[model samples]
Target: MRTHESGRLVQAALAAITAAAAFGVTACGSDDSASSSSSAEKPAATSTPAAESGKITADSANKGKSIKLGSKNFTESIIIADIYGQALQKAGFTVKYDLNLGLEDVANKAVEDGDIDGYPEYTGTALTALLGVDPSDVPKDEDAAYQEAKKLYKSKFGFTALPQTPFTDSNSLGMTKQKAAELGNPKTISDLKGKSQNLTIAASAECFKRTDCALGFRKVYGLKFKKEIKIDVAQRHEVILKKKADLTVPFTTDGAIAANKEVILKDDKQLFPPYNVTFVLSQKAADKLGPAGQKVIETVQKGLTTPVMSELNSRVDLDKEKPEDVAAEYLKDYL
Candidate 1:
């Protein structure tokens, strides 16, 4: 398949921030970052000839051994780690956690060093941050992105990029509902072309430099802001809610978007890369766990949808519920 390959050079610089994505993220979860009102079809468990049922019981699936699970330092990552760790435990694997393990760089190193087995990851992050692919080269179609990433991880690091969760946590441009209405109800990024001069934008501090954010607007959509402000992910939504910025970048699954009732602009240009969550397992660990491990991981991925994940995030970000507890509650249904 022909891949978009512009901005290949800028990927080197963006790679650094992609590793240190240690800051908290606010996303609504889905390959679709715009219009949280829509839901993607939930994926079924991974199909492997190793088992008749989609789920494989851990005890029957693998020899008794310990699996070291790791996660980046964020609520969503931690919660996902627990979901996988806890499920592995139920399957009778001696699961140990290296949770809150800094950033994707740290987690990627651990996996490469054989210090851990696997953890959930975003397809775009793994593609750009780990595999050195240009963001423009990333496939916009969710499954295409996953397939491209799967091939790269297997070839580059001898790792397996398992089937991704239906939910994605991609970046989005959002404005107040009123602001969107004032612009004649523009829906897609292309709609903002000539309107950029009237719009003030805000995004993560790195977005100013990252091609995926502000830079993507100019390069991909031909839009340039009248003014741009840098705000941490934690406060980006507030800037939009307060009308201080006409448009702000927020993760598609960010709980704040729902909490603040903001409107997300569609990325009709297909500029941003897919951030669909998937489990990237080392070839060694995957060989050891076999189909049973695939079942465990796929079950977790299959159960999560955009709305379900958003609520899970809300429990941690808004309700102050522990990620572990939230993970436990969500796992009960699948396990």
Candidate 2:
């Protein structure tokens, strides 16, 4: 539980963010009342247990006796990485971490080279970004996905993918609070049908090109934007604030959206793939953790959900809480 102490510091920061996220967001949405309250509200839905999703294999037992944890450069990766590190630590293995690693390619190289164990990745991101496969047209759920990804990973390299969860933090659509009200779109993708085409959008070149972001929304919702503006990634808030873009792409769990009070549009057509955060374990490290790794897997398997992950992300990115601290505090809440 020593990790808990570290986590509490994160929780305090998250609590502060939860209390003060207004400074970071651009406030997009038609539902101003609901959007305004999302930050202050303690989650509203009742918890429903998710079906089992991960495993600690004999291969893993013999392999992950001691593991290195890796993470991408993003805040969510940092938090998830800290959780993975603490879980391995509690399971009785010594963990070394290499957080803030660049991306899947870098993390994959590190894991393959035995520099780090494994890290979290999204199903869509791996298939679309890393592997050059199109997940946009596939069924928008997780069944057979782990198996598909495992085959690709093992065949391409010696790595392994653990069970995936329902925790999704995918790209979303957002507008200024006033803009949302002006648009009058609500509750579904079709709501914007005749209008979105006139609104200018701003996002990453990737987001603009990706199926889930622009294409999917257009196809599924029968809507098209009048103009699309490409900007550097992660700078949507600034663009929206300056009115450079009429609408922008946002992440559902992103803290900046909530902090700025940006009104997020609903994806009624379910155009996005479910990118439940998953543990992509390095084969080398899995061998060192032994049976204790299974316990760690179980602990993680029991908690992560869309709502849970969304809040955690909001805390770290918007609230200014450290990812490591948020992970630790989250473990305390569920453990």
Per-candidate Cα lDDT values, in order, are 0.70, 0.61
RMSD of 1: 12.7
| C-alpha lDDT (0 to 100) for residue 3 of candidate 2 | 16
Residue-by-residue lDDT tens digits, candidate 1, 90-174: 5556666666666578888989998788878889878877788888888888999899999999899899988898788888988
Q: Which candidate is the best by lDDT?
A: 1
List pairs with backbone clashes in candidate 1: 26-254, 27-253, 27-254, 28-252, 28-253, 28-254, 29-253, 30-168
Off by over 4 Å in 2: 1-66, 190-194, 215-227, 231-233
The per-residue C-alpha lDDT of model 1 at residue 191 equals 90
lDDT of 2 by residue, 165-283 (tens): 65667778888888877877464557777888788888777665667667666656767788878886557777888889888877676767756888887776677776766677766
In model 2, the Cα lDDT at residue 192 comes to 77
Let me know the TM-score candidate 2 reaches against the reference structure.
0.71
